[model samples]
Target chain A: GAGVSQSPRYKVAKRGQDVALRCDPISGHVSLFWYQQALGQGPEFLTYFQNEAQLDKSGLPSDRFFAERPEGSVSTLKIQRTQQEDSAVYLCASSLVPVGRDGYTFGSGTRLTVV
Target chain B: SQQGEEDPQALSIQEGENATMNCSYKTSINNLQWYRQNSGRGLVHLILIRSNEREKHSGRLRVTLDTSKKSSSLLITASRAADTASYFCATVPGDAGNMLTFGGGTRLMVKP
Candidate 1:
């Protein structure tokens, strides 16, 4: 693809329902990252992946939140028993290298509403 | 947590004027980058400046980084109505693993 792509541009879920968001990063991008952005706030890091290895999970808010990039090309973020506070835009970004001096390309994001 | 803080939560300027936004971070950073986001849209990378470099320019954008003050600024020259968007600053911590920490953005509105 020409750019990073995310699925389900908008989602409405029940407070206790589970939801999954997907990201298809730019071809050959070696690093993938997930971020959550609240209304009127900047994106907060959720997790990071270097290829198929999950190098960092410290930013995941809870055990219920899980992300996997098994193939090192596409990734998915799953949130179980979603809460009202979880209502936010889930962003996906990819970098050609580790986010050092390079800028990341971002997806449109999945606006998840846990009502 | 967010490592950077951008000032002037909102800015309004005329189309032909220049707009500047400032950002400050709390940690040693390998580099600083800027991004823009229109309402309901994804972020678009603008520029990146390495810690060793004090300034960098790309087209109509000029970025300055002050490692001593742990601050960076983005200047958009000859702003246009189409340039209206939320501008953010993100840092790659020199000591931490590869993750970009973003700041609360500055919303700019350029009137035509």
Candidate 2:
């Protein structure tokens, strides 16, 4: 693909429903990142992946938030028992190399609404 | 826990006028990057200034960083209505490898 692609551009879930967001990074991108952006706020880092390894999950807000990059090419972010506060735009970004030297390419993101 | 804090949370300007936004951070950083978001969608990387570099320019965008003051500013020369968007400053912590912490952002409205 020309750029990172995300699925389910918008999702409306019940407060207790579970939702999954998918990301298809540019082919061969080594680093993948997930972020949560609240309305009127900047994106907050949620997790990071290097290939298939999940090196950092420190930013995940709670135990209910889980992210996986099984094949290292595609990734998924699943949130269980979604809450009103969890309603936000989830962004997926990928960098060709390590991120310090190169800026990331972000997907359009999935806007999740929990009511 | 955002590392950077952008000033003038919102700005309104006419096309052809320059727009300037400022950002301040708490801790040392390896580099600071600027991003633009349109309609609450994806963020587009604009420019990056390293800790040692004081200034960098890309097309109409000029970025300045002062490591000593832990601050950075972005200047857009001859802004256009298309430049209207939310601008955010993100920092790579000095010790962290690739993680970036972003500020709340400055919403710029360039009126035609």
Candidate 3:
């Protein structure tokens, strides 16, 4: 892949339905990040991964949000019991740095609409 | 919980006019980077200014940082209609890996 790729470019879920979003980062990139962007706001950091380790989940809004990077390559963000407020664009980004440097490449993002 | 807030939540400018957006953050940052997004799409990295640097430029884009005041500004000169988009500022807190906290962003509309 030339850049980070996100699956299900758009998702419409019933309020309370569970939804899963996927991300495929560039090959060998060691750092991955997930963010949520509301209609008029900037992307809010949700979680981050360094290889397979979830070092930071502090930004996950609530228990309904969960993200995982199982093989240090692909990642998934699952939201349980989706609410109207959960309707937003989910972005995935990847970077390569032993210490995670100054550059990041972002995916097109999945637009989720909770009905 | 918005750490970084950009002033002028929205702006409208003529196609050839320049646009400037300011961002203010609350905490000590290792670096501040600017990004641009169109509609609800993914953000495109614009430029990065480290805590130690005062200003940087890339083509028509000029970035100035005032870490003392926890603020930064992005200037786009000779702007085109295509340059009209939401601009954001993101901060990486104190050498933390790749995690970034972003600002609310400024939405700009350039009319022809």
Candidate 4:
């Protein structure tokens, strides 16, 4: 079975530039999540989607971080006006349900470097 | 925010030796889970122990949770070089969703 997948394993952008990270969740998985992990730290939640409907965005650092999952399977996390503070790995995960009885499967993530 | 804290921050052990890592959290949780990451990229789910269940085992991996202490421990018996990676403990509280709060992981290096 195909697990979650992310594109452009690595990206480098200049300050003030915008970047987009993509995630492909497993088929029929209703719950999707985005997280940001800085160097030597645990991942922090960004947003969550259930069947195309975003349930939470409180973890988003600021307005510059936006996510969308139109088809309920594919998701995108876009960061605007990149900053060195934004340099980190963005992780995507999906699970069968929201209550989390079944653990999530994560992608390799995209490492972004803002110079 | 990191849901829990793990220590010793880094550990070095040899093959055939036992490796132990500990984690502690502040909030009430439905379950606690462990994950392993290699090179800090993708993380693989290792095990999950419910708050009510004090201990659970999968093969050579043993996870023990102490609700009163709000802590958990992961013990690997006869570790291998493949076990060298960062291990994290995630606390899934009663947030109505499975959103996890992870901790700063413990880096384990196994010298074979």
- Candidate achieving the largest lDDT: 1
Model 3: docking quality category: medium
In model 2, pairs of residues that clash are none
Window of ten residues with lowest summed lDDT in model 2 chain A: A96-105
Question: Mind sharing the TM-score for model 2?
Answer: 0.98
lDDT of 3 by residue, A41-112 (tens): 888889999999998998899999999999999999999999999999999999887443576889999999
- Compare candidates 1 and 4 on TM-score and give the better one: 1
State the DockQ, from 0 to 1, for candidate 4: 0.78
| TM-score of candidate 2's A chain against the true A chain | 0.98
In TM-score terms, candidate 4 sits at 0.97
Candidate number that wins on DockQ, 2 or 4: 4
Tens-place lDDT digits, model 4, residues A7-54: 879999999999999999999899999999999998998998988999
True contacts reproduced, candidate 2: 0.64
Q: Model 1 misses residue A68 by how many Å?
A: 0.5
**Residue B35 error for model 3, in Å?**
0.3
DockQ ranking of the models? 1, 4, 2, 3
Distance (Å) between predicted and true CA of A1, model 2?
0.6
Predictions: Cα RMSD each: 0.8, 0.8, 1.3, 1.0
Order the candidate numbers by lDDT, best to worst. Answer: 1, 2, 4, 3
lDDT of each: 0.95, 0.94, 0.91, 0.92
Q: Whose TM-score is higher: candidate 2's or candidate 3's?
A: 2
Docking class of 4: medium
